[model samples]
Target: MSAEIIETLRSGRLANLGLLSDDDIQFAEATIKKIVNNGSETIRLVFPDQHGIFRGKTLSVHHLVSVAANGIGFPSSLLLKDTSHRTVFPIWQKQKDAPDYILEGALDVIACPDFRTCVDFNWASNSTLLICDLYQRNGAKIDFSSRQILKNATTSLQLAGYKALFGLEVEFQIFRIIDDALKHDQSQMPPTAIKTENITQGWQYLTETRYGEVEEILEELRQASETMNLGLISTEIEMGPSQFEFTFGVDEALTQADKFLLFRTMVKEICRRRQMHATFMAKPIMPNSAANGWHIHQSIIDLNSGLNAFMASTDLTETSVSSNWIAGLLHCARDCCLLTTPTVNGYKRYQPNQLAPTNVNWGYDNRGVMLRALIFDGDPNCRVENRVAESAANPYFAFASQIMSGLFGLENTLVLQPATINPYDVEATLLPRTLGEAISTFHNSAINRQFFGDDFVDYLTIIKKAEWDRYNSRVSQWEQDEYFNNF
Candidate 1:
């Protein structure tokens, strides 16, 4: 009966749609055998949603044999949630010519498992986790899937005979939990913020003394990452209080995106167990708080020649490909700001002389520039670092924005503006100073529609618009302090 069920799933819509390849089938069988032999009682079937948050069902070990091939069915409404976890789309009040699956009465969207992404759940005893990509019931790919967006972007790059690799520098803060904030009044659609105090009074960057203070927690996090194979290269103390940064090894864009999401989830789980809170929020609203940034180190390879495409042939400093890629990033920086930053709080981190870029520009090994070129004489590691993204940005979307924008430059053979010695003072376009400005810029861009399909552009726009509206409608603490006393 078990064998029959497994075969039945392997022969289902996935096979018909040509998604269940021979390799995929073999991988699933291997996973089942490993799970059964290891006595794993539960399996976490998960996929990153629109915001790249891990969400899925946990199933029994007995069902793994079948589910390994069949996958989990998640409500389509899961894809429509904003950052608040509130379903932003009007599913019940569906409009004419709306999306066919998501927001259409919350129909089932299949979470197709990629067995290659299986990892041992070290935090949970005898549990395993597998990541997935979303698909419609008819086996068509979900246009709005965060994973699929990166997949599509990568696929496009491949079609042009180039492949992209990315490395991630992730920064976040960990604090001692003062209050769980679970009282009646604190409960809402989005729960109230929990109170936390800095564990380290950190103004010292990468000081050994400071590292010794939190070595235990950092080691615990490091071990968890190692067990899950998250490609963690190093963990170091960042410039601010209780702020830490984890840098990972380079890999293909899509694989890195998966690891990035899992790493974020793992950090939170490990921290919360110790009565601590971990936040990737770009700028935490606290005294003397330093902002977190996600600096993406990216490079492309020419598949035909099997060489680094950005390598300068004779030009001592930079190549045409790298220049065009930089220009593409700068050109689309305004339009794709919503994808990179994605939050009202994110914009607050872009300040002059703060190890963050405030304007659209690139410079050679310059920390302040938006794009920092790291090219050396005939080194295989010639790459560009994009520093504009917040640590909280969705990895898939941010990487997609880079790939799509870089491709735009390569295809058009655009030239970059001269590398700025003084990035902040250079004649360059400033990044959107507010989320509202970003939304308007993205909404007006024809390029956004050209890259992400019309469906996704519209879907994301509505979701972001809802978030912006929520942020604007609220009478903030500033409003109360500034006007209440005077008025």
Candidate 2:
């Protein structure tokens, strides 16, 4: 391991560390030494991919120092892939067409470990964990690195003397594992009985009996979160069968994203050990069931003044900076849809009267609106809740997109439309109905390109277009059933 990792491990105060750099590897080595003392010699060097899946290699403690110094190697092509793991970029084709250029085709990439994320492996017998960032051969950050995008966005905000504080309320489904192979079949996996039992029994809100039913599972998650030093606020049974909602305390935007990713992984692993499966897919089981969403609550605090910019007034009113912020979120709701609800399945949740917003509108204490203002007159902690993102969304990209959009609104002093008493009947525009439409809007937005950079936007468009193309080619059951019988 590097000297920094060694020093980090020796400190034993891992939880309080900030963003990790190459110098922190000494601290990590000290941490590893402590783990070894406890008799666990295995460590997983994991990194989040484009789809937010954790991918990495597990190394022995004996090799930690060497791996930390040199970094672990992964394929460069991983960054050029879509959600389905298809290489969307035409790197090979371009190289083949131009033989004079030096294109090694499949080059090796490195994942530099982030030692500050070092946490004890709750599920492993004797192991610790770390997250990494992918780096190109020339030591340049990959264009599609979600974590890097968020870091860049934070840097912009910090430069303006403001800080982004984020809190997440994410919903997901948990199913009992009946059979390994059969469970892989999406149709038979959710088990309708699970939903019927939980929904039909009138478990609309959190109650003692409902909590008792899943006490053991919830307990395990709570313990695991505490062990990992995750700032977990609360977790409650959701509306759907085996569905649950987890909330986290407000933190810096990037740190909150990391915590969210780790917490989701922990819940899935713990559920699996108990013969259960947890899915973060936006609309896993369609129709008849309420869709799951990841609601993001955000605010901007003045770094110099130490005041929340989104809060106004000593009493609830019609005018405030908070109201203007809500206006900004609603104004860019259509353009922001691509980042918030990026997947095709995500659009299915925007149905009328489903508690999910279908149009770009704001309302006070209205969950049916895309932007809900949560100011209680003089509450300093008041902020805006954006209820558009799907659970599968990359938090970094999603949060960064929102920050840029809202910042634009704030800078322009945009006037928001009047609050709608009935969001469904309001005259506001609706969000993009499909991923294709959302991508089109995103690609056409000059402002978005200006904020996120032309190269990054172009790369994202190409990759996501490939995903849409792949999805379009596959014939769905609806098409087969409808056409096969009629035609």
Candidate 3:
């Protein structure tokens, strides 16, 4: 407790709290060297909130060691908020069902920078962004935090002698702003949607002319992605008006989540600075706008042999690893929709024949089905693409849903159903057609309760139901057209 002990370079609150390991301290020492060597003036500490939005504070490089050792603090309620930045939980009154740590006056949570995640954002020469791990004052992980959920799933996989590889196909739209919505009335919670026009005309899916017109901005995007080391695979003009897609190369589950969130933040910032708007909403409520789908490509690796589990010589069946995984996915697809399609707007992407899924089914290399198997002979890179999610889904939860469901299948030896040739006309169970349906399905799922636990599931469904309740309370245009006129 003496000043001399406290003044020691590595001794601080986080160290006394026994959260940061010696390796973490050593890593911090190395990071300080990097800041001095690279001349970074600011250190950005960030964590992905429940909705995958980056929230954090930037510190002067002079205090990097202290911040890294003692850890930066932020209000815990950041994770309890809904997408609209509204606190949905009853934090004021302690509930018997919820833990005191979460409801204790919205206490400060500690954010310790992960040295391995330290990266110099090239464009921001003066700043370094480090993804942090959130912990309680008692140094326990926040079980419902996006990173913790994904970590638990991955740990389960590792314990079972397997690993997960994940790749992402992200689709979003870019628009020319018609109004920035700076009026006083627009400054409400979450702000009003800004008015926008398409930067390009409709219906040119990857035509060179369309790419030619927007090549400059496209290059700008490509450069920023590459600079961030996001493992860029390819960028393409999507089927929708002014919509674009970017695919990332496969990586470990956690790394891919970080890259995905970073990409989302980067795209929006870069576009807004250029007097443009970039939207990752599942289906932006705009005329002629196409729904954006986030296709998750996943495969498993055996820890013993380090071989692709999906690369089997035998045909996919109940005995095949890939089959077991896919069967798990199909079994839980309906229940997990709340996580994979986490927004009221995301459900609109499920229309028939829109290159998005409406039914819970799988097919071999099929875009029409919910799960598309790409397993082929002699292909070590085979994976199944889950097209059930929208671009706005939180990558941590989305990836965890895959790991958790796949583990359930492997453990139970679940049998894969026959692949459907006609997904639109199949007798398969339907995906939840609306967010309300998703909430109900998720709330009632025993398997979800088992995997994510009752506490996390209830926390999520409660917030989503709040959103659904708000949506239903509002009078829609269709409701006005049908009821207001008819009544």
What value does the lDDT take at residue 82 in candidate 2?
79
384-467 per-residue lDDT for model 1 (tens digits)? 999999988889999999999999988998777888888788467899999989988887789998988778888888888888
List, residue by residue over 91-117, the lDDT tens digit for candidate 3.
888866556688778889999788788
Question: What's the CA error at residue 2 for candidate 1, in Å?
Answer: 11
TM-score result, candidate 2: 0.87
* Alpha-carbon TM-score of each model against the true structure: 0.96, 0.87, 0.96
lDDT of 3: 0.87
Each candidate: RMSD: 1.8, 5.1, 2.4
Show the colliding residue pairs in model 3: none
lDDT, model 1, position 465: 83
lDDT (C-alpha, whole model) for all candidates: 0.87, 0.74, 0.87
What is residue 441's positional error in candidate 1, in angstroms? 1.3
**How many clashes in each candidate?**
0, 23, 0
**After superposing candidate 2, which stretches have Cα over 4 Å from the reference?**
1-26, 95-104, 182-203, 312-321
What is the per-residue lDDT of model 2 for residues 322-364, given as tens digits with 9 covering 90 to 100? 6556666777777767888888889988888878988888788
